[model samples]
Target: MLQQRQDVINHLAETPFWSLIKFYMDDEIVATDRKKKSGMDLIKIIQCYDSKQQKFKFGDHEPKAITSEDVVEIFGLNNQGVELPNTDKSTKNMKDSFVKAYFAKQKIGKKNDIVEAYQKLVQDKTPEGAKATASIICVHLLQSLLFATFGTYIAWSFITICGALDQISKYNWAKGVTDYLFKRINKSKKKRKNGEESATINGCIALILYWICLHTNLLETISGRENMIPAIGRWDITKIHKAIRDIRVEEIEISGRIPCVEPNESIGRGIPCSEEPTEEHSNINQEECNDIPYPEQNNESSKKKENKTTGRKRKRTEVRVEEDQSITITEA
Candidate 1:
C-alpha cells in the first residue's frame, strides 16, 4: 500500500505540475517563517501586465520585459512534450469514460466533489485507492490551479491523462499553461479597458505574480538560490511590504503599512477551503466539498497507511491532449 501511494504521488512529481506543489509548500520551500502573499497586490500587477509589451508595470517600477525563457523558469514546466490535445472541446468520450470509471457518469461533479472523494480514498489503505486518489488530484489541480475559472462542473477532460501518466510527460504542459495565462491576460485586460469593473482575471495568478517578480529586481534571494530552478522556490516575499491600490517598489518602505483586513489563517497554509476535512472523513458518497488543496508534500520515502485491500479494477482509458494542453481517450 505504501509503495502504491508513493508510485502514484511520484507520477505527479515527475510532471511540470510539481512546480505548483513546491510553490504551495510555502514554509518548507522558502525555508523561512511568515512569508505572506496576502498583500500581493496581485490584481494591480496583473492589470498592469502588458502582454503586447511582454512586460508588467508594477507601481512605479520600471516596466520589465518577460521572455519565454522567463516564463519557463517561473513555472518550471517542461516545454519538451507535445501540446495537450483539445479534448474538452473535441469530444465527450474521454470525460464520459472518466466519469464512468471514477464517479457516477451522470453525477457531473465539481472540484469539491473530487476533494471529498480524495479524502475518502487516501484512507482506504490500498494501491487501487491510492491510484484513484492521485487521478482525482491531477484533474482537480489541472482545473483549480492551471485552467482555473472554468465554469462549475468539473473539467472532466483532464481525467483522460490518469491512465496514461507516463505519456503526460510528453505534453508541453508548460507551454500550454503559459499560453492559457496569456490568453486570460489578454481577455481580462481587454475587458477592463472596455470599462468592465470586474478585477478578476483568472489563470495561474501565483505563477504570473512570481513571473513578474522574477524579471524585476525587487526580492531577496531564496536560501539555496544557486540550485533552485523554480521561481517560487527562489523568491523571498517576507522582505516586502503589504499595500493596497498601489504597491511601492525598489525597497522603499511606505510611511505606514496599509491596514489589511485579512484572515488569521496563514496565506501559506494552503487554499482557503470552506471547511477542513480530516483523513478519517467518511463521506465516500458525498458529492460536494470545499475546493481541494494541494496534497501534503512529502518525500517519496515517506511512510504509508496500513493495509486495506485494493478495490475492483475497471477498464482503463489512455488518451492525449491537443494544443490546448489536453487530449481525448478513445478506448482502443
Candidate 2:
C-alpha cells in the first residue's frame, strides 16, 4: 500500500493538469482497472482513500470504504462519472485564435492613432517652426516607445538620454525666442521695401537671440517674470547648463553682425540702415573712389559719410594734389 501510494503521487506529479488538480483535491488511487463495472464505483474507491488519508496514513488507515452512492452525491455525476462534456480540441484552438485576433486588432488600432497624431503634429503651422521641431521630437519619441515596447530597456534608456541632451543643446527655451523673432520678422517684412532680405536678417537674429536666451540663463529669468510656456517639455534647470555649454559664442557674434540690432532695437530696425547702400549707390561709390586722384582720401571721405550717418565721430583728413594739365581739349 505504501508503494502504491508513492506510485500514485509520482503519477500525479508527472501529469501537468493532474498535479495542479491533485494539490487542491486530495485523493489516492486504490485500483487501476480500466474495465470498471461502474465509473461511480471506481470514484467511490478513490474517495474512500482520500477521506481516510486525511486523518491517517494510506497504509495504516482502516476506515469504512466509501460506496458508489457517496461518489454520485459528492461529484454530482451520473453512473458514468460524467458531468459536462469535455471541450473538443477544435473549440480550444478557436478560443486561442480569437484571443490572438482580438489582440492584433487592438495593436493595429493603437498604431493608427499614433500615426494620425504624428501626421497632425507635422501638418500644424500655427506656431511657425512648430511643425519642423515637432516632427523631430515625434521621431525620437516613436523610437523610444518602440525600444521600450520591444523590451530593449537599455537601448531605450540610451536613446532617451541622448534625445534629452539634444533637446537641451538645440531647443532649450527656444519657443519664446523663436516666436518673438517670427513676429518681428513678419512685422518688418510688412513695413520694409526689401521684405525677403529683412525677413532673412530677422531670422538670423532670431537664431542668435535663441542661443543667447538659452546660454545666458535669460530664459529662466523671462520664464519666471512672465510665466512663459516652456519649449518642448517641462522646464529643467540642467537644460540651461547644457545649453550654455553647447552654445558657440563666436557663431552668435557672426549672426549678431548679420542683423546688427542693439539689444533694445527690434529685428528689422537695422535693416533700413543697410538698405540705404543700394547696389546702384555701391557701384557709383566704387566708380567715384576709382576716379578720385587720391584713393586714400576718397576712402577716408567714404568712411566719414558712413560715420556721420551712423552718429559716430570721424577724423578730418588733409589731402594735397599736384595736377598736370594738357592743353589739348576735345569739345562735344
Candidate 3:
C-alpha cells in the first residue's frame, strides 16, 4: 500500500494538470451528491481533461506553471516562503495583466502578474546604453594612458643628452620623440597581428598621434592653433584632426584668406617680415606692409608688426578753410 501511494504521488507530480482535472471532477460529484452523471456531463469532464493536457504541454512552465512568487523565493527575495508585498499597486496590476494574457492564450489558469513581474525584473537588471559606453571609454582611456606614459618615458630617457646618445647615433630630439611614438605604434600593430583585442592600446596610439601632430605643427594647416589644444586632449586623433580641419576651412572661408600649408612645405624658407615704406605717400605704405601676408602667423608677431608699422607713419594731411573764404592747406 505504501509503494502504491508512492507511485501515485510520483505520477501526480508528473501530470499535475490531470490531477487538477480529477480534483475538479471529484468536486462536481460531491457538490451534486451523484455517483453517476448524464452523457453531457461526462463529455464536459473529458473536454476539461483534454484542455488541461494541451495547456500543460505547451505553456511556458511544464508540469506546473511557475509563478513570480516561486522565482522570488528561489532568489531569496522572500524569507519563510512568504509572498512579497505589492508596494506599487499599478505595477502589480500591469504584471497581473501580462500573466493573464500569456496564460489565457495557452488555456492555462492564470496566476496574477507572475510573467509580468519576471519580465520587469529582467529589464531592471539590464545596463543602460550610455552607462555601458562610458564604462568602455573609461577602461580604454586608462589602459591607453598607462602604456603611452610608459612609452613616452622610455623614449625621453633613451634620447636625452644624459643618456646613451651613442647607442642611437645621428638622432635629434624630434627623432627621439618619433621613435618613442613608433615603438608604441608597432607594439599595437603586433597585438593586432596576434589577433589580440586591445582598445586601450588603440586609444594610446590615437593620443600619441595627436601629440605628434600638435608638436610638429601639422595641426595648424587643418585648424588654428587656438582650437588645436582642445581637440588633441579628447584622445581621439581622427576626431581632433577632423575638427581642426573643419575649423580651419571655416576660418579661411570667413576671412577670405588662403589656408596655411603643411610645415614641411615651408621648410628651409626664410622667416617672413614686412618691408617698411620709404615715404609716407608710398603705395607700399605702413598699413599695407603691416598686414601679414600669412594670416596663420601667430598673433604676437602680427601684433608687433601692426604696432611698429602704425607708429612709423604720421597721420594723413587735413584740409583747413580760412575765414576769408580762401581754402588753406595745413598739416594736421
Each prediction's whole-model lDDT (CA): 0.47, 0.24, 0.24
Q: Give the CA lDDT, 0 to 100, for residue 52 in model 1.
A: 88
Per residue, candidate 1 scores C-alpha lDDT tens digits across 1-332 of 32346755665677666666545533234212121122134444555667787566545655664445655786576777677776234333534544565566434555556666667766766666656666677676666556655343434456566544555677777777767667767776676567764434445555654654554433434545744666655753322222121233332122222222234555332222232222232111111122344432111111221211111112223321111112122223
Evaluated against the true structure, the overall lDDT of model 1 is: 0.47
Model 3 residue 46 lDDT score: 17
What is candidate 1's TM-score against the reference? Answer: 0.61
Question: What are the per-residue Cα lDDT tens digits for candidate 3 across 115-156?
Answer: 232233323323332222222221121222212342211111
- Per-residue accuracy of model 2 over 1-332 as CA lDDT, tens digit each: 21223433343233212221231232111111111011121111222222222211122333322222322222221233122122111121213332232222332212233334434434444542242323223323222221111111112222222223323223212232233333433444344334333111121121222233432332233233232222211122222222222233222221123233343554322322222222221211111121111111111122222121111222211211111100011111
Error of 3 at 164 (Å): 9.1
Please rank every candidate by TM-score, starting with the best.
1, 3, 2
Q: What TM-score does candidate 2 reach?
A: 0.15
TM-score of each: 0.61, 0.15, 0.19
Candidate closer to the true structure by TM-score (higher is better), 1 or 3: 1
Q: Which regions of candidate 3 fall more than 4 Å away from where they truly are?
A: 1-171, 199-332
